[model samples]
Target: MPAGTFTMGDSSGDKNRADGETPRHEVAISAFEIDATTVTNDAFARFVEETGYVTEAESFGFSAVFHLALAAPEADVMGPASGTPWWAGVKGADWRHPGGRDSDLDGRGDHPVVHVSWNDAVAYCEWAGRRLPTEAEWEYAARGGIDGAKYPWGDQEVDEGGWRANIFQGEFPRHNTCEDGFLTTAPVRSFAPNGYGLWQMVGNVWEWCEDWFHPSTYRRGTTAEKRTLVTDPAGPESGQSRVMRGGSYLCHLSYCNRYRNSARSQNTPDSSMGNGGFRTVALRVESQA
Candidate 1:
């Protein structure tokens, strides 16, 4: 665990930033240990094997899989998500079958497990004696040692010399250049680690956090008179969706520019998708005392 203070949101001049990321503010984080990488298929498999736990996708009998991964026939039969047409609700698309019943982990044991929900992540964290990082903690950690940088690495171009993260390349939803040498989920350690030695903190998968989704969360925390210095803010008390940080491989600058450290998104607790996964964080026992 490493404790520190950091700026918590995007600046007004930051391009492609969403309204939710407004009112840039500073946050003080307490000491905590976050995973260097997301939980892999092997790790999640062990959890399921030992406890016989079933993922929400499995229980619901379907999940949102990327359209690019679906076969032409499957894609035709299963239309894309209403809001984001790039994703398709694939039947039997559980964690085991990432693209439906035909898909399997195969040689991707080291890849981050997908089609996981916030509830499933919570169960894994509980079983592992850890918890999800709050959105503030997640941002603080993802920023590494740098302040207000666009990525875990400095604000260099994504493919400066070569691919840094596993984000989408070329045209989105239609064609992928695969310049990063990946079409779907890359291995958990496919890229270099951030300053904190955290792998894939900004891409490959969208990590679930412990905060509730509220567009004006930061705005609500401030008054017209003055700004409040919120230490270790835990986000809203209640909401319909949970916070999801670190955009996935489906992310592209052409559309979703949420692969940045401070960028955020959300999903229902039970909504599982192929790009949704999570990492765990352990609070310092001494701090808890």
Candidate 2:
């Protein structure tokens, strides 16, 4: 991991930019090692098998799954999330079985693990002796060394030539063209890595970060008199939800454009969904001078 300063929020007054993304500010981050790819099914399965740990979804008896991915009983019983009916709360939708009781990892060993909550991510990080990247660290890493770029690879064309990260192509929620060759989560490293050799940083799944969500966290830094150089911001002291970055396969211009490097979203720490997953980071130990 390389430590440096970078602009941290949306500088473009893009109409697609969300309100929480405004007041673009500068952030300096210390060196830290982060996983090149989001946690995969095989890695997560190993953690589960070794620790015999049960994810919150398993204990809660249900979790959010994409409505299109579920059918029959699972879909029938668990109503969709308010407004965003694309997300259905399905019984037995744990990290191991993303769709429901009937679903399994199958051949998706390399795919980024889904149906994981912030708490679940923290647990995995703890077991692995790592920690979730802070919201600032996440955005910096996602930028992949290119400052103020719209996307990780520095192109907003999205599906220009059927390349780039995995995201909704056709019509979001209603349809997915799968132009990127994936309707849902793609295998880790399925696409090109960024400038920092980080894979799937902008899409595929929303990675959990170590920060509480607040809409105006960057507003103060934007003041003309205040020093805009913030170092390792940890977000708000308290919030209803934890921060999530990188967007997901469900992202589309029709409804959501959060796949941008600066875009952010959040969910309850206990809420696990098919579009959510995470990677871990480790503090770089410095030798005494």
Candidate 3:
């Protein structure tokens, strides 16, 4: 995006204040180039082939999968994750086998590659000579230059005119109506692109950001003052978990309505799951004689 300044954080009154998406602030970002869509399985496969890199999930022998998307048999299923019974730690649930051992990329090569941890994303970035967008950069790009809008497409409810994003349509975690034509993940380019020509920025999967997450990150430092324009705020210097944005297919209005421009979430760097993925960005290098 071109170098510009915009207000960041939740402006909508209906924000999950606990997620620290509040205390709206002004942020100035420099010019940078970002992927139009999250990394697809086909793109990730090429990275794996080129580097022979094994993802964290592949090394861990298992990864988190939504219970409803589990394709593994009873033998491969490892039961639900603690506190979140909707997720199960299933064996062989890596990017290649998103559902479990029984699943494969197959015709879903164009879909965002899930089960990729923040660390895995970083590895891929290194191999590709790119980097994950900072939390601020991600949000700014996601906004698509719409300024203060709840979503990338200017605050019209996601399903208002039709299915704008691939999110839960029915009672979440129980019965997915698939009213949006997707139960888990739709193609990376399923929805209309934002004004910036970026697709699926608010749904399909949670994209990892290159920033440590802290509930009070915004309220802790100089960014706390709305008058101060935080220039390219990276995030907390140190934290246990990294930031994740854009929500995912499981997001629902009745349950997790985080499919907005300012919604935020986090996970350990090494944690991988079926609803997680990432995109990359590159700094603009001017030509020189």
Give the top-scoring candidate (TM-score).
Answer: 3
lDDT of each: 0.86, 0.84, 0.91
Q: Model 2's lDDT to the true fold? A: 0.84
How do all models score by TM-score? 0.94, 0.94, 0.97
lDDT of 3 at 160: 90
Distance from true location, Cα of 31 in model 1, Å: 0.7
Arrange candidates by lDDT, highest first: which order?
A: 3, 1, 2
- Candidate 1: stretches off by over 4 Å: 15-19, 71-77, 222-225, 287-289
Greater-lDDT candidate between 1 and 3 = 3
Cα lDDT, model 1, residue 228? 63
- lDDT digits (tens) for residues 1-289 of candidate 3: 8789988888687688678986888899988889999999999999999999999999999999998899998999888878889999998889999999999989998999999999999999999889999999999999999999999999899989898998988887799989999889999888799999999999899999999998888786778855688898888889999999999999988888899999999999999999999999985545445
Score residue 131 of candidate 1 by CA lDDT.
96
> Which candidate, 2 or 3, would have the higher TM-score against the true structure?
3
Off by over 4 Å in 2: 15-19, 71-76, 221-225, 287-289
Give a tens-digit lDDT track for model 2, residues 23-119. Answer: 7777898888899999999999999999998999889998888877773363434787898888878887788788788878888999999988899
Off by over 4 Å in 3: 287-289
